[model samples]
Target chain A: MDFLGDYTLRIVALGAGTLGIVAGALGAFAVLRRQSLLGDAISHAALPGVVLAFVLTGTKAPLGLLLGAAFAGWAATLAVMAIARMSRIKYDAALGIVLSVFFGIGLLLLTDVQKQPDATQAGLDRFLFGQAAGLLRSDVITMMALGLPVLVALALLWKEFKLLAFDPGFGASLGLPMRALDVVLTGLLVVAIVVGLQTVGVVLMSAMVVAPAAAARQWTDRLGTMVVLSAGFGALAGVVGAVISSRVERMPAGPTIVLCVTVLVLVSLFLAPRRGLLWARVRARRARARLRVQAVLEALLDLDARHGDGHAHSEAVLEVAGAGRGGAGRTLAELERRGWAERRGDDAWLLTPAGRAEAEERYGGRR
Target chain B: MTGVQLEIQAIAAVTAAACALPGAFLVLRRLSLLSDAIGHSILLGIVLAFLVVQELTSPFLVVGAALVGLLTVVAVELVRGTGLVREDAAIGLVFPALFSLGVVLVARYTDSVHLDTDAVLLGELAFTPFDRLVAGGWDLGPRALWVMSVILAVNLVALLLFYKELKLTTFDPALALALGLAPGLVHYGLMTLVSVTAVGAFTAVGAILVVALMIVPPATAYLLTDRLGVLLGASVGIGVASAIGGYWLAHALDASIAGSMAATAGALFALAFLFAPGRGLVAAARRRARQRWEFPQTMLAIHLLNHEGLPEAAVENRIDHLDAHLGWEPAFAREVVERAQRRGLVRSDGAALELTDRGRAGARSSLARTA
Candidate 1:
């Protein structure tokens, strides 16, 4: 109720929501291409572009800054590719080189800007970690204008992108222009990152790009579903993180938004119905229990075949049916608890008639 | 340079060299970007350590920060073990979350007054000369110099002591493990040193420069040489040079010293990328050009040999018909003929071309190699 009534909450929500949708949709491709860290590289590389734009234009207009950032981000990607292709240096190392160097240049320009006796550099630091409370309607409008095209492009080339992300070799076989598609996709990623930088900042913008997509992936296998779900999760994190940070004292919106998406990712990892850690653990436990029960029952049947049902079987002898000593011991104890087998002496078990029938029914064909 | 300027340069140089040492291994391992992760996450480590010790200059802070840095690596590894997400995604997921937590901690508790966030992100190397380390009232120069010197010593000592193990593990971890080198221990040990170096340098260079210093120089050196020993030496040399060069650039522009240092490192890497004699872009292009000329000549020689004294030779050997016969552009066919003629690999008579004995021999050798 409080969030609904608040005007700042609404603005933060709209701005962060737009950012989330754009970032989440683009991030799916990045994550799929194993370029998940590209977001981090591009965002860091953008700092120089932002600073250069300010110095070149003599103004900190978002449009000029965004253009500069896009250029720098694109150059960084190209540099990374060039370094990887031209030398033995791997892509990851190239990424590091580009990220740090570009950021370093940016820092130099930024500090130089601070040396001048001016007020323009006042909010420049906000680009590092972002200050969502400062977002104006114009910034939000600019984000929508930029974000809409990215989404439109993504829609226009959905099949090509899917093919490129999943199987570029096959896409090439299909006579698809993969290189052009790659450039266009990376271009979209650059745009998404630039738009979000003002709100989430450079340091935390990568999380907006990666976390939502990562979370969405855990929930589905279909690319289309993953994209839609990622966009939804991103929007949800955006609105929730923005609203909470706006209400809380000393809570920065950028980090808060990142943390909110992280929470979603963790929840999906551990608690989602079928793919979750909890479910996997439960399934594994059930499988183990089934195996142990089968082994004990089979061992009991072996004893019946040799010396009749009442004959006690040694723990070591029963282990031949399957599993370790501790496992067989536990299986025997479990059988007795279920009234499937009766303990005859120390370290021994005898199968009940009912247990013999059950084992026969389940593992009869296997033997 | 002035005395203060010299001190600043010394600090920056030592810091870069220290980062470059462990960075070589990271680049080789293809985990160079992990240094960036460690660099940012270490801020959280520093802030948490500061909260506990309540002293900015406490040794416990370094230990706490180093431990937290190690924790970042371990956390990344743990997430990677899930097999659901990729290594880069895991790295992307872990560092930002940890870094954001650190940011939130700094923002909420300190109000950013006690610990200037700007200094942490873009370190004030120019101010390094002011933070003098005094022991018992005796001035010990700049604190950054002392701290970075200690880190450098640690890096050098560790590198010297574990040279063989590090080499084996880096080049072939499975072989190192077979020889009882404990590759896992070496990996964690190297990670610890990386974190220690990064944390120590954080005060002088900030997170961005520290990451740049760690990765860029090593990568540049990798482009120049293939020898491990030379890589190490060149990386350290490049790191120091970038530091000095960056300082001067900052002086000329009157900008952030740490930032200029990072830019210098990037510039040096770009230079190596384009100009390194053995593995540079230009050299590679030249090599490609040579292969292109030689390959077409070989194909022409082979074609001539295949159709020698045959009726098809009259039509196939002609320069105009070769384009359609071999699917080459007409200009390319003429260029190939001209090149082959210059090399004496082929004789162009009026309207026909024939491979010489030398051309046939060259074709045979090349074809043998391919086969």
Candidate 2:
């Protein structure tokens, strides 16, 4: 409770919240455009940029470093696109190439920086896995400055961005510069990614981009609503994760935030209304139940039609219909409960008038 | 290089080449991201297995890590199968979460000394030679070389055993399925091999850059060749070359060796992208440049041959009329005529153009090509 009113906690929370909102919103487009892995490649590519900025500038300004990260990430994505377009390399392979290669070069450079005789570079590798506790008020403001423009750009070109995400080919056909738009959109993504990199690090930053949007996608089909919900999920998870990590020693906020959002993803994946796993299972069960009931009713109707005057069948109906599994008796019971079948004797069954009509309609279609 | 240095390079080269074998198939199948996903997430497997075995050198740890690699693939497929997310999104969702769990576990439960998380991401290939595989107190070799040598052998055996199935499933999954080759089974098998290779290569390249070895060389090979056999062989060759080249680059710079190898592979890919003979960007651009002049000159020769001594021969064959009749930009037409004349394909007589004997032969051949 002592940490509740702490000012530093609030600032870190705000920084993480800003990260979530920007990354989540941009990530919605990335996921929809099937460029979810692009975020991973971009983040990995940002490492060299962050290190290079420090090596060149002899200063570690968050804004300048993020700009370098954005530039490097954007350039890497362009390389990925070029590799995919120019050669027989698949887009995924191209992405892997850039991701690994850029990170490798970054590592190579990071070590080179560390070896400098006058180098007092203490925490440059912190960007690799973020040093979240190092978040300053300026860092928070830097995130806002970087993130807010992307949001404003998103607002200004809502229709074009939507077209860019959903149907770039159609947008291009409509005389839009779809390729240029894609480049700009990717630039925006790189900015959003660098905004989060300070809080989430390179590897986990991609999870920040992808997880919230993926979770939100399970809850909505509309783009605007999905983006809003994704932002909410990201921000909620970010604050909670930052606070939890601050409370627990040795717990970094980036992975905590990643795991927290992962929990939301799993919850959404399994429990969201229309698209969730639970609903799918329920729908499957309902369909299976309906099929079994129909089969039993048809069996009863077939007996009536063959024996004349609603002739009855015994418990053998369940056997004949092959419904004798988990709900073997329940299928017949369900029919009787629906007043579609009735008990003729202790062990016999007969089709009701409603059941006969129901069976006839379905059975007629089959015939 | 001393014996130790040579051993290090041998391990690096073997690891690189072994990874390349599966790398070739992964690239061909267009599921190269699986390598990235598996590489990161297998850290959890190694860590969890290490907790149980308590011995870093235990073979069960390798098996456990490989199994976790398979689990990562299974988890991605399961998530993607739900239709809630696409494959890439599923990949993005699954690996980081699992990897983060691994990081958290390592951070919380384990000491940093044994399983340093930094070593997991950027492995210390420099220290790999120190961990010798001693038998009866005799130094057999570096443990990494033995691990990677077995993996290279496994990959080679797998490649030879399932080359047909892999090729069939890669280029034509529908036919592979119809032929009852069980492309799905082959896919899982390929994934298993990938997971195993990632585990074997994990100690040398670390979790992140194993993807570099597993994906980059084959991807570079893909640019150089179109045939699967050639692609696989080229991947191995390129991967080994990167390993050897990277060892020296690191030697020169005092940087991370694994990182250097990945960087070297990346540089190789960049080279192949620009200059691979048939399919490279430079090659294609050069081809276009050659055709720019060559194609139009052939057309000019054909045009001249068509109107030799005819009533419209002067009008049609005149260099001045080329812009209007042939729809050239006047400048382009003059350039074309000049190029043709320079090549002895046509001669200019006053304002009329005449085909030379060589020009007639060239025009006839052009016509024959069209036929």
Candidate 3:
């Protein structure tokens, strides 16, 4: 109870939850555009910007670091685009190249910064991987302030984004500024990523962007529903991770948050009603069972049709049906229970009127 | 060694080798971002290896990293199989979580770990040789070169052994499956190789440079050739060239070596995109312009052939038709006619312009080819 009552825990949870909503909203489109990796690339790329900003300003202020991150993220995006457009290299490869180069530069810059004699540089390392435990009230407020407008903007452009995602060519043909929309969407992703980095860090921020959207996609097909659900899932993971980490003496916030997101993704993969693995398996099983029952009924009908009014023995029918004597007896019992068959004498069974009608209807009125 | 001269050679070789092998597969598979994912996810492998061995220089580190890289592929595949998340989204979901886990572990266990999340995520290719591998008192500073060589060998052998299978599967996976080839096995095998290559290169070159190595060379090669075999060889060549070039550039500027390598690769790709024959931007533009110039002349010939009703007589009026299409500019039309005649497709018959049988055939063939 005391753990829950802690002000720091409450603040972290609130901040993470807000960031999650923003990330979830942006991630839905990022996933749809197949630019999920872009999130990872940009987040990692932002490191150099953070270090550079610190070098220039000589301060580890949130605003300066964020501005630096945004610049780096945008620059990485541009580099990716330039590589893709200028070379025969595909978009993914370009993204890979840009992500690696930018991040490497950032790492080198940070190493240089760390060598400097500054106490503020002491905790700057946390931003590299993320240390959500160190999040302050001002940080939380900053996240919410930045996150809310981005989420609201996404909401406003939800329909446009959906159309753009589903078919950009058609969207362009219909006079939509697909390029503008793309920029807007990419901008939103960058903002969400930069802000989320505070909570999840560069290494894991990509997961936060992708996991909730992926989980929500399992439960719904509609874009609006997916976005809403994804946001909900993200917030839930955020709150849960924050709470759990706060309870533990030494657990950091970022990994716990990511773990929570991972759990949600796994659950969605296995248990979602319409598209989950378990549901698909159950559907397949039911389909197979129905096919077996139908096959048995078809065989019985064929036997009746062949024998006409002569009433062939059940043993002969079982042989024709490719069932063993024991198997035949079990099928007979099942048919009798369903009122589809009746024992006529010592070794024969007859199809009832309803059974005959069912067989005929099911097998295209076959004998 | 002078920093500039030494750094250039080191960066160039590492960058070139890194990009060449993976870039080919990335282009073929169309999962270019897989490189990005592998780059980030390998951090987890490194961290995990560090934890188990408690030493950064353990041979087990490479193995552990390779295992983690393979784990990332499995995780991505598993996520993809869910069908809820698309392929890129699945990649996005898996690598970050693993990377985060790596970061958290590092933070918890290590004291002010210099290999931070960004460093792990991006790589340290520029400073790679600074960390030397001393085996039996031998000085092997460029450890990445050896690791990459082995990985490259594996990649080349696998590609050669399964050339036909890989080509068929890459061009048309469903068709390959229908023909009784298990695409799943090939896919898993390729992914495993990618993982091993990525992890092996990570320590020597750094993460981001590995990406540059994996993607840029193949892309440049793609621009220069249409044949798959040639493309692979060329990509590797381009990668190596860029690595060497970028290393030198970085040393010259005192900049990040990995960044310089990537920039070099990017510049190579840009050059190829602009100047390569057939598919190059300049070539394509030239082709388009030539097509526009010849179109009206071809159209005029077709019109004259339709009007004259005699294939032989059509040759005499070919220039007149060309003139008519351009509003009867005699000098230009005559030039066009002479050019067409020189190609053995037109003939002069006194004042009337006409086409030869060969000319008619040539016109038809050109039209068909364009269409």
Candidate 4:
């Protein structure tokens, strides 16, 4: 409670939560565009930019680092595009190469900085994996200032982004400036990644951008609903991770936030009602049950067709279908409830006209 | 040369050789990013091995990392089967969770362990050579070299033995399955090899550079050629060249050796992207320009012939008419006129144009093909 009462913790938590919301909203498009890995790439590529900015401005100001990171991130995106378009290398391969190379250069620069004997280098190192506990009020304000316009732009261009995502060819035919829209979207993603870097770091920032959106996707297919839900999930994960990190000792808030987002992703993977693994299993079970009932009805119809009076022996029919006696009996009760079958005394059951028609239609009338 | 420098160079050579083999297959399968996932997720294996053996430098690390890498593949496949997420997203989801778990374990057990995150990410290539494989104090700084050599040999043997099978499965899994080949088994086998190669290389080059080595070399090779055999050969060549070139560059610049190596590989990929024949940017532009010029020339010729009365049998003189319609210089007009004459499209004694039997047939066929 005392840790939570600290001003630094409160400020950092608020900033992380707000950044998480923006990241989650922007990440919906990133994931949909299959550019989730771009977040990882761009965040890493920003390292060189940060180092260069430090060298250029002779200060470790957040704004300077942000500009440098944004430039490098966009440069990485351009390199990826060039590799993909001009060469046989696929987008993933291009992304991997660019990310490693840029980050490697950044590391070389960091080592150079380390040799300089300056205490300010400590703050720059914090940007590597982020230290949320060190964030100031001005940082939080800056995050909101940048995040608000991004959210507004996304709102105004929601229809265009949706159309471009669903079908770029159609959008182009409709005179939508798809190229410009793509640039705007990529710019938004780069900004989100750069801002979130203060809280999530370069290595784990991608998880913040991808995990919440991926989790939210499991619960909904609608784009607007997904974006909103993902934003909510991201905010919750951010607040929970911040609180937990504050309560605990020696746990970095960035990885903690990523861990929380990851937990939500796992939960959604297994437990979402509409499209999760558990739901899929339940749906499969229901389908199998329906198939069994249809199979029984089909067997009964087969027996009726073979007999002149349209009647069949129930026990013999059940023996041939290989369903358990209890299952057959349960299915018989269900069919009767649905007005699909009728009891003939205690030894036999017969299909009603509707049952016979449905059975014939389903099984090709052979039975 | 200093002993350390020589040893590091030798290890880099071995690592580059090891990554090149399975990397060729990964690129072909479009699973290049899986190498990145495997590279990151192998930390789990290393941690698990340390937990079991309580030692950082044990053979069990390789086995454990291999197991975890294979597990990453299986988990990704499981997620993909759900149809809820696409293949890329499934991969993006599963590996990060595994990697994050590994990071958390490291952070939680930092005091009890000597594993540094910096070492994990960047690798200690300089120190690898000092950890020698000496039996009875014989001073052998070649354990990594031997390990990589054996792995590379096994990989090559497996690829040679199953070349046809791998090709069939990679190009068309359905046909391979129908022909009674088990694609799943091949997939798992390839993944295991990738894991082994990744682990072997990680010791020498570190995770990030290993990832760069695995993807960039093969991707550059893909740009240069389309044949699988040539692609494999070119990838290995590129890997070796980058390893050597980057080692020297690092020495010259006094930079992080592994970082320089990865940057070199990236530079090679960029070079190939811009300059490789057929698919290169300059070549494509040239082809487009040539096509543009030839298309209009062909259109002008067709229009000239059509203007001479749809020219089934014969055509009248039309030089002045062509010049008026096409707006060509006399030299350009003469070139077109001479080309048509060479093709037997006209018989002009400085006066009239006529269609020969072959020319008439060619004109009709060309028009039909165009239509």
Candidate 5:
């Protein structure tokens, strides 16, 4: 509570938190639409717009710069679409093209602005990898003002957006103007991305967009729950990132925030129910153990069937039935442990009647 | 351009060509973004190599970058194999993590080291000539020029030697597997070339230009031709053009050389997108327009032919009736008929339109084509 009492800390946390929610909500749509990297592309493309806006208006205001960024983001999306559609270059390549080229232009302009004697181009370079410490009260207010509308739009068009993400063809069939809805959604995504750029930066902003939604996806199946969870996770990462970077010497907040969200995503990937890697691994181990026990039981049943009078089978025979070398010993031991079979000496085993019945049932009584 | 400028341009061209060779295959395989990932992640390798060898000019730099570049691909594939994330997301996840690690390493070691993050992200081709390679106490021209030349040669030789294998694996990996070409090995080979080229180009043009040169040239070439050989040649040509053009542009603007090169490459791509002969935007648009114009004229002739002596022949054969009958605007209908008439496919007989013998023959062929 005392930590939160610091005014500057509170502002940075709020600003980062607001950014995370907006980016994460929009990122869910981007991720679902398989345009996860659109955030990256749009952010990079927004660089030139930011500089251009400053030059044109000569204003250091956040709103004006973000508006310029939105325009550039929209243009980049269009360029990517055009390149993908008009040429053989795929969407990913088109994305790369716009990203590097626009960023290059931005760099060139920044350098030019810096070399000029009269222009005070300080802090413009922060857009590369954002410095959250630079966030002002006005900037935070601007972000909230810009962000709330994007959130409201996303909420208002939740059903339509869901249809667009999950089943655009179905939405179109229902006379929903799916294409126009897509444009609006993309526009909203641009707005969300532009607002986050000053905090997370062009290089790492996409991670903010992708990681929260990705983590949320691990914990939920329903879209509404996922979207809500994603926003929360994103905000958590942002605040945590802001706190950590503030405490640590010489650590930039944007990448720190990105890494925080990435850690969340990795944790979710490993520990979430059903889809988690830990559960999958556990299930696999159980499945293998079950198969081995069944194999040993079947081998015993086969020996009993061949002898017709309850003869003990040697361990070598079990090995020959596909349990190679050491597997035969372990399989037999497991069977004995279950009272499914009994060892003759140390090298042989015979199935109990119960084991025979169970084996027959398992194999559909084929034997 | 001055001598120094010429040398810088030459270095840029060589770097671009080397990158473009592997880039062509990358574009074809739809693994274009993976190149970007590799370019970014190779910084880790360079930093590790520097830490180990304690020298910036060692051959191990290239080796280290190649190893990490390969690791980046392997790591991405491993993540993708888990079935959690798609290929693109996996790439996005892996590279940023490695890049951030590299950035932190550079930051931590900056006091004792000369590693400049700015140069890595944005290169300085303008200063390449000053960093001359001295071998056996003899000046061996710019270090960047020699390194890039060696890499360019290596790339060209590899592409030439494995041309068939590369082509087979890229266009149809399953067939390459059937033929025992070992496409996985070829894929690794191509990746190694990309890594080597990226590292070689790093000192001259930096990561941004490396990504640009690696992708844009081949993408532009894709728009220009369908043949792989022509595609390769066109990409190399475009790469050299962008390199030189970017050099002059940077000189004129007095900006960052690498940024200018990337921007130039982008401009070249834009031009190819609009104006490439077969598959460009302008070409596609023109083809669509021609089709639109010709289709209506053919329909008009066919309509006249269908009503040659029928009851509606009187109405349908009238040129003005075309607007109402076909639901076309009056001006558009008039234009179609005039075009047909100019081509000797139609004749007007005072308020009535009729098809000539040539028009009838044309209509029969159109019907045959449809049938």
Candidate 6:
């Protein structure tokens, strides 16, 4: 059976895709600003908000819970900023403090709510790890309603937010209210986190904010391109993970989606152009090879100036030309492969006309 | 209290102290989130070890977890060294992927392995007493208590032996490097202790509260003291206190012990953040309040001294026109005038205000400081 043919599968895939796009876009700013961990802190902090909203409102209406999650996450963000700024404690420590304490508070609340005799909170803990199959049509609707405004706001504040991410001090010096803009940007991040909490769950939602942006960063230097690419990667992972998990028996979509996105991050880290690890290794290897070829060519050219063209230089001369560091045989073979140098009588060598020309182009004028 | 209750508290307190010991250094080094990372990544080790050893309580699990914890640090450094990702993002990238893999493994083999999700995330601090360590036929109290005590003792010994080295390296790495002290060696050593401590505390504080215990108490202590010795001692004391307080909080509410403990630690940090002398929120705000008046008075004095004999002196000195001349509000000008008069910095000559000798000296000193 086709996976998208199923109603629940379609709903969850759509919901997760929407969440990915929203988180991926907003998360780019967080990643660029060096606050990738702030997303982690806020996602954990939103747990108590989710539980408290359920306890106080007696309704699991998405809006009320979302508002509660947003408020708590926003407050946690403020607390982390305050602690980092007011005290000697650094930002990581501050994030640690706020995140765990708030998460602890959330856990306590969750346990308390579950113990109630009349409580209908059986599905509440599911928000912790997220069961994407539990995502209803209404939940998908709520995600869209929330994500639309968030992406719109992101588009509207694109320039200011970009400045806030890259050079907030310069913006502040220009009287741009950098602090307020920071609050707004972080607030959007909190919203981004809360919306995804139902789909990805609170625990893994932090990865959603980081993996996409980090992967996208390896591909582009432009902020606009990075943001768009990040969103695209996130959505791709979400839809694919959702669809695949729907087919697999007993495989939870949330972790599966996280696994998918993580694969993307790993792929990007090793394979993306320019900044990719594989590319860096390849470029370094090529550069080293080019240098080796150039050195051997220049040595041949040096010999040409001394002994005239096409002279069969002994392997001993090649060793001297190689200097104390030897690899003359391999260099000669590579030269032969490139038709640049020819071996004479097993050990001696001669530079071809083209090889001499190439060497001259590289070293003759500079030498 | 019953022996069971006492043993549980002992495990909690000892675990807290053990975490706080290396935790203070982590907080000082700005690697507090590494605790969070280490705590989660160690789960992978524990899970893999469990799969092989077929026992969750095996010491091999601790060894495996510690190795994974170290691997996490190595992995983070590798990613960050690439210059493709920032340090925090590197952290954010590495831990969850490890944790997600662990979750996947646990979920995949749930039939054969009873890796309780709640027990993994929240721990079973309350059940620590039930898991008694037995030697030959002798019951030697709770296993967690024994694990934490040995780890705590190891942490204390390590701290005492290397206190100076740790202090110098943490406070001034460049100076330490120039003096031939290997900061990198000290860093890995501290991280090893953190990883081992995290594994020991994993059962009592759970994984997340391991981070809370390691960070909150030390951060709270940092607010109260700048001395390294005092910081270390206070961090331990605060951690133990939070453990006890949190144990009681969970007892009262019948909630998660580790979470309650973390909340208690946070509450203590909150108290210090709001009220710690010289550095608390209240103290800093009060200091700024005083500066508000102090700054304006110095500016007024400077303004008066600059114009005392100039053509504008009469207009600038006139009490009625002071607001217009200085761009101050009329009410504020009057208030400044009254305050200056009361302090004997100025005197009224008809409608014009004159700066006295003390005011002139104050203005001159202010000018000297600025120059």
The collision pairs in model 5 are none
Model 1 C-alpha lDDT per residue in residues A1-367, reported as the tens digit of each score: 7655487678888999999999999999999999999999999999989888888988877788888888999998888887787678999998999899989988888888888887468667778878898888778888899999999999999999999999999999999999999999999999999989999999999999899998999889999999999999999999999989988998989989999999999998888767778898999999988877776787778767878546777878877756454558877778888888887778777778788888788877786
- Per-residue lDDT tens digits of candidate 2, residues B1-371? 79988998999999999999988888888899999988888889988998988877899878988898999999999999988899999999999998999888888878888887788787889889899889998989899999999989998998899889999999999999999999989999999999999998888988789989989999888888778888899999999999999999999999989889999999999999999998889999999998889988988888888888899997899988888877888889888988888888898988789999999999999999999
Please give the range of 10 consecutive residues that has the lowest summed lDDT in model 5 chain A: A322-331
Give me the chain B TM-score of candidate 1. Answer: 0.89
Least accurate 10 contiguous residues by lDDT in model 2 chain B: B113-122
Best by DockQ: 2
lDDT for A276 in candidate 6 is: 94
Quantify all predictions' global Cα lDDT against the true fold: 0.89, 0.89, 0.76, 0.81, 0.85, 0.88
TM-score winner between candidates 2 and 5:
2
> Where does the lowest 10-residue lDDT sum fall in candidate 3 chain A?
A322-331
Docking class for model 5 is medium
lDDT per residue for candidate 6 within B1-371, as digits (tens), equals 88887888889999999999999999999999999999988888888898899887789999999999999999999999989999999999999889888877777765534776557677878888998899999998899888999999999999989888899999999999999889999999999999999999888778888999999999999999989899989999999999999989989999888889999999999999999999998999999987877777777888888889999898877878766767889788877777877887888888887889999999899999999
lDDT per residue for candidate 4 within B1-371, as digits (tens), equals 88778878877876887798788888778887788788878988888787788787788989999999999999989878888777777777777677767776777765534876667677767778767788897876568777888888988899999888888998899999999989989999999999999888887777766777888788889889988899888988898888888888878877777877888888888787777888878888899976755554465456645755654323324555556567777677676667767766655655455555655666677789989
- Expressed as tens digits, the lDDT of each residue in B340-367 for candidate 5 is 9999999999879989999999998999
Report the Cα lDDT for residue A85, model 6.
89
Categorize the docking of model 3: acceptable
lDDT of 2: 0.89
lDDT of 4 at A311: 71
Model 1: CA > 4 A from native: A1-5, A309-324, A327-330, A336-339, A342-349, B296-364, B367-371
**Each prediction's DockQ?**
0.80, 0.82, 0.40, 0.53, 0.60, 0.72
The candidates, ranked best first by DockQ, are: 2, 1, 6, 5, 4, 3
RMSD of 5: 2.9
**In candidate 5, what are the lDDT values of residues A1-367, reduced to their tens digit?**
6654477778888999999999889888888888888887898889888888888888768888889889989999999988898788999889888988888887777777778787777656667667688898999999999999999999999999999999999999999999899999999999988888888777778788888887888888899998988999999999999998787776778878887888998898899898889999999989888888877777777777778988788988888987553477877778888888887876878888778778888973664
Which of 1 and 3 is the better model by lDDT? 1
**Candidates 1 and 2 compared by DockQ, better number:** 2
Candidate 6 local lDDT, A1-367, one digit each (tens): 5644587788989988998999999889899989999999999999899999999999888888988999999999999988888787789999999999999999889878878888877567767877788888988888888888999999999988888988888888888998899898888899998999998787789999999999999999999999999999889989998988888876778878888999999999999999899999999989877877887777878887887655788667767876214477777789999999998897888889889888888788997
